[model samples]
Target: MGFFDRNIFIDIIEWLPENDDLIVYKYDRHDNEIKNGAQLIVRESQVAVIIEQGQFADVFYPGTHTLSTENIPLLSDLRGWKHGFDSPFVTEVYYINTKFITDLGWGTPNEIMLRDADFGIVRISAYGSYHVKVNDPVTFLKEVSGVEDAFTTEMLDEKLMPFVLSNFTDTLGEAKVPALDLAMKYKEIGDECEVLLQTKFDQFGIEIANFIVENISLPESVQEAIDQRASMGAIGNMNTYQQYQMGNAMGNVGEGNSEGGSVNSTINDAMQMGMNMGMASNMINQMMGMQRNAQAPQNQQAPPPVPSGPGAPPPVPGAAPSQLSFHISSNGSQYGPYTLDQLKQYVAEGRVNKDTMVWREGMPAWAPMGTHTETASLFGGMATPPPPPPPM
Candidate 1:
């Protein structure tokens, strides 16, 4: 075709990207004819690029401009026609949208490998939304749009998702925040990720206006591990936790049994805890007793053990009464053969009461405190009245 035949006239030129477009149609026309006086319209948040022979000839911002030799000297010069051509000329016109596009979704394609404080190395998935806009339309067209007929949000999505994911992974790895804590630091993580992305986005003539992290997640197994760790911390003691698990298992067994389930397991756990508590109490008592004994007068002799047989000798008249020891029966159980001093302490602490049955070496049978002369001193304080006698 002749050079003149190749010319096509464009009397009116204008382009507005669709509401969803990110980098919209690069130009209204691709290397088409433009009449010298054609009206070119540019809208807000938009720029129009004019290309001649694959080279940028001119750029127009928002507003109306008449396409003429005076306004497009670069095109005229490129054509080597100083006087300007009377006939229509060929040029490529591209319109770039610079408005912020919000709510573009992004997510990691595969699990991101990261180190967790509690779980060591773990894999996690993250997803969220972001907003982007063309900050430099010229560079955007040259680098992002390239030869594409139209650069769309969808295209941008396809192109930018990898950057988003890879950058996010890198930022997360650098932050070293555990997966379990990501929820609490979502905004912080997102902010750091946004900062990392901004530099790269600037190179592409795009800006990330806002970034959001909707959620960060862990695999089921990892989550379960977290839950177990949490449970252990909450329980606060390994032995107690073992007992708790055993108790739960025992409870489940009871639930499964149609016949009368034994209370034995529950009793066993309670008894075990009680025994541990008693052992601790006994150790404390021993220590305190040792300290008291050490501080006692050096000349005072240690008390002799009470005689055990029927022919045992009587207490010496001059010596202080032998420290009497008695066995306690409480709540249908035998507790201790505690010394009178220990029993007095127990009474003061309300651990032992008048209603509690008592037995001693010389006692004919188990009897209540009010009936025992040797133990009556335990409740002699001028306080609340004595408890009623135990049932016969």
Candidate 2:
């Protein structure tokens, strides 16, 4: 085909004969133009322009376009003629929906479903879908694999699947519980995975829509340990909290007691009683001091002796005869002085020894002077006293 005879109008249906075939179009080649009744595959980069011929028009598939002075059928020459061609260029866009899967050991699937636990002992499952659309067939063929191999199961499982799983597991491990505990922390883990993978997969021209962690599984042993720890912590916290509450209650009670009248009365009574006890203690101390002073020994000068009367006889000489006195036995008797020597002589002569009573005229009752010895001549009695006269 000549440069001027090149057909520019291309139909997509005519160029692509096979379902999975890729066509390439170029704008500088003459043979790349479509011929009458001949099928051709076009490159995606080829640019075409419309042409008209006498009573006929032709559509050129994407391919090389040539221009020359030679009188040949070209797309610019066809004004009214109708033609059909197929598109050689196809553009596809790919979007990736990533999900994370964790590893749950022996009873992975069952435990994930049953307890719905999230821990290091468990595994996570990450799931994702690959969405693809044709964009530029030529560039896509040069840059990437064929369309059939674009979204192959093996490619997805190999390239992106491991990334999804690793990202998800790491994110789940780093996920923190919510402050309010209103929602599962896995949702936050999913969000973290989305952010991380978005940056990692940017070069692949793949847009990651969503990354999610469907389930997390825990081992039975880990679950049991967690339960035990929770129980112990709860009990300990309850005991400590109860003690604190009781202390607060007691403090409040004490405060109330002080605020009421009872404590006031008790305090007042204590103050008054203390004052009274203080006064009594002071009085007792004063009295003890006075008693001690009164009982203390006194130091006084001796008194002067009294002088003897003139009528009193002088004391006897060295022998000092005994001073004795007696009464008379007769009625209306008068007594006299008796000397001790005289009395002793009378007693020696058996005049008087016992059974004798004497009375004086001034005496009120008879006096029994048993076994008397007169030392003076005061009494002349050696007989018993007589009875008194009867009353009138």
Candidate 3:
């Protein structure tokens, strides 16, 4: 009775948040009886909710309020008391900041398992930050309000982090973003994540202002495998690689002999062999630059004329010869210059569609698969009638 006597009048009931937080419950003498003439102060971007006997009574927004029977009808009804009573009342008031709370971190506690285009099934880890806000304080109070002196963002994060990652798994899988190309699709993934999380957040009276993916990474072993595959693809044909290495070795030896003022017949023979093979213009020039001035007369035959007739660019010396490969345009992306065999595989895999645009060497321009007579053969058995029995 002595402690309650001094708290009858609450002149100030305000919450000054230390940081922009999700929700903070305001304290008014810690559930003590608030006199009828007491003051309730709420600031902008904040909402004050009153709870009487474990039920929400009234809500105040962005203004000063006086505690009185007129505005306490809901409270009076919940408390089963008549209006204009002379006695003071007991209630709980919580202030929830509606402003955006940013820089909250979220991440997958466990590696995300996804199928990649190049690496097949691989595990990856991702981390990001997001901004959130409270949209409905009443619903938040009913669902997640903790009976503490103050409810900080940490508590919200404990509940939200799991929700975010769960939604991330579904959204990322549905987007089908390749792990090798995940970096390029951050914005796309983030946008989709926001949409995917909106419905769930709405249920808790929360709004996700922005969701961002800062980094996505794969396991070291998986990354190494991908790198090796890419290196092989870049090296192309093995025979061409051997020729290129031979030319490079000769070039280095020629430089060494000229520096020592000695003749290397073996080196000269290898250089001549590379030149006779119609090495690329660039490689021929590089090898010739290493030759000594006195040795120029020994190999005086003019360089072979570069073959150029616009059939297809001559196979680069020491490089895979350019082959007739088709470029596929699908889903707003140019897939590749796939060889005939690879194109057959793609068709067999059902990756090509009637509207798929394809172009190959000697074609003036790209045309739909169904429109090109030559490439149309790639899409065989696509609703075409079977040939009549021969001479039946």
Candidate 4:
């Protein structure tokens, strides 16, 4: 057609993507009319649509189509003008890209909240890419690429990104996967999100081909806490670790023995910690023994212990009295396992009180030292008789 021609008569109609990203393109037909017998070329990975006054007339797949009554029944039925053989028709055509669009990215623009078991509520962010393709040309044109000359993946991303993030956050939160375990569940989460997001995109005739979860990032504070937790191990064997610490400190103490101040200080500090651990372990064991007694089965057979008389049961053979060594609690620090003689000195100095907490071997639990038969005599002088009040 020449510039002088007022009306251009077109014979063939088709479209080659302007770029790889082009998803939908409108066939530009500036005042051009297609003769009734014009050919419509639809290529592979593309779908051609015919529109009459904003209404979908017909859709064509990969083939050469003649715009006639027999080939396009939808448009022919709408127009119903078969009287003239050389008549021209004015209509709009759109071509949709059906090829998979890969590497289209998506990410959470802001941190989303997730409830975690170990760390309670945690804030997290994630990013990944997706792939998609046009599933239905007619619906895509109406819902997504409406009234646009061309639609690219960049434009689609603007709409798809939010949908992806919405579904992704919902999926992750609903799964309630712990923040620490999120790394291991990335693939499972991605697969689920793809399925969920595809359902939402189906309305716009976009199919999600693939979704990926590259990395889910925890907050800096959470990461630091995790590092510290790893550094301070959930120590499995306290006994072994305590032994290692004591051994190492003793080696150091021996090396510094000539330096009197440093040597004594190291010995005191190391020995105090060792004593504290030992007493704490004993206290816990005592509490556990009481718990076992309380929970003992009621129907179980048991004989009451004999009182101290002729009927008393004999002590087990080869057993001897355990050494009387006591631990005193003062100012929240446990002091030495003082022998009976040393404890008498502590009582004389007014440092040990009748109500002070103390524990020793063969005791069921820690208690006021005066409550014990062995230690009651230590506080004998502090008790007074009430004979004068009774006479009154």
lDDT (Cα atoms) of all candidates against the true structure: 0.69, 0.36, 0.68, 0.71
lDDT of 1 by residue, 145-248 (tens): 78677778888888899899988888888888867777899999899889999999998899996689998989998887667556545645433343334333
Residue-wise C-alpha lDDT for candidate 3, range 18-112, written one tens digit per residue: 77654776674754568776789899999998878777788899999987777879876776778876567766778888888886998888998
lDDT of model 4 at residue 54? 73
Could you tally the backbone clashes for each prediction?
Answer: 4, 63, 0, 0
TM-scores vs. true structure, each candidate: 0.62, 0.29, 0.61, 0.63
Predicted structure 2: clash tally: 63
lDDT of 4 at 147: 71
Identify the runs in model 1 with alpha carbons over 4 angstroms from their true place.
1-8, 26-32, 229-392
User: In what order do the candidates fall by TM-score, top score first?
Assistant: 4, 1, 3, 2
Please, what are the lDDT tens digits per residue for candidate 4 over residues 1-392? 66424357788888977689888888888778877778899999999998887789889999999887666666666787654445677888888989999969888889998888777778999998889999998889888889798898899999888788889989998998977788999999999999998889899998897799999999997887666455335543445455445434433432353344364455467576687766754554453231222322234212222123344334335533333556655334454455566566556655455766665554545566677665666877533321364554
**After superposing candidate 3, which stretches have Cα over 4 Å from the reference?**
1-8, 28-32, 225-241, 251-392
lDDT order of candidates, best first? 4, 1, 3, 2
Reference-based lDDT, residue 210, model 3 = 75
